[model samples]
Target: MAELQTHYPDVVPDLPDLYEPLVLFYERGGEFVRDNAGFLDLTGVLFRPGTLRGHLGAPSLSTLSDTVLDAVDAEGRISYYTTADGQGPLLRRRELRDEQRDELFSRDLQWEPTDRIPGSKEEAKDAGLVELDEIAAANLIAVILSNTSR
Candidate 1:
């Protein structure tokens, strides 16, 4: 972790207290996007609302699943992860920061919370948000692969 921060100072943020597992999640997500670019392209579901919902089953599930994928896609090397709805935690975090900015402006203050903001790992765990368990991730990947192969 210290090595990553030291070497990739610009890529990795200075969140000293961030949950360790959350960092793993982000790293693993990037690997998945890189490794499965072919499957993602063949499925054509990452950025399409109708196709995403169709592949994932329910609308809410699709939205949540897409949000995670969109986050990874936005920060990944692949250019195909673009989303039309601006979904994902990154967007949500931006929205929260904007709201905080507005509130601070109205109150004539210039302070920002340094701990556990909207998109932090603590908030995610407190909200019971699991970015898909191992079984689910494997199953979804398998489904995409199988469907696209046919």
Candidate 2:
């Protein structure tokens, strides 16, 4: 656990005190753009079972399902590992994040909790809000189209 504290400082914030597993969902090799499905994957980021309590910080595939090809949800959230009988969401809420507006997937593709839910602009500031801009949407379409051509 101390090794994690020494490494991947960026992931330290995610190492909660809880004994349960911690998943750091990624955008699944996709770009950061409005309405992108990969951005919503949650299970793709699981580090490994019991890693949460050990505080072995940073995200890893070990924490998630055994397979990488598993299906991800429309929001980019990974489906629960029913095959592995992994943990499922304790609760569900609809919300957005800042990554939804970025041009690239980089670090911005990561998800974070926000106080506000989707469809409410007023709560954006407090929550890691995602504002849907036409430019962002168009950018996504362009990327998808360009990639398909290749």
The 10-residue segment with the lowest total lDDT in model 1: 101-110
On lDDT, the candidate that comes out on top is: 1
Q: Identify the runs in model 1 with alpha carbons over 4 angstroms from their true place.
A: 1-119, 122-130
10 residues in a row with least lDDT, candidate 2: 81-90
For residues 85-113, could you state the per-residue lDDT of candidate 1 as single tens digits?
32311112222322431111011122222
lDDT of the candidates, in the order given: 0.34, 0.32
Per-candidate TM vs. native? Answer: 0.18, 0.18
| Clash pairs, model 1 backbone | none
**Candidate 2 lDDT, 1-114, residue by residue in tens:** 546866877777555434332323233433333234334333333222343467445333232322212212234321111111212111113223433321122123322443
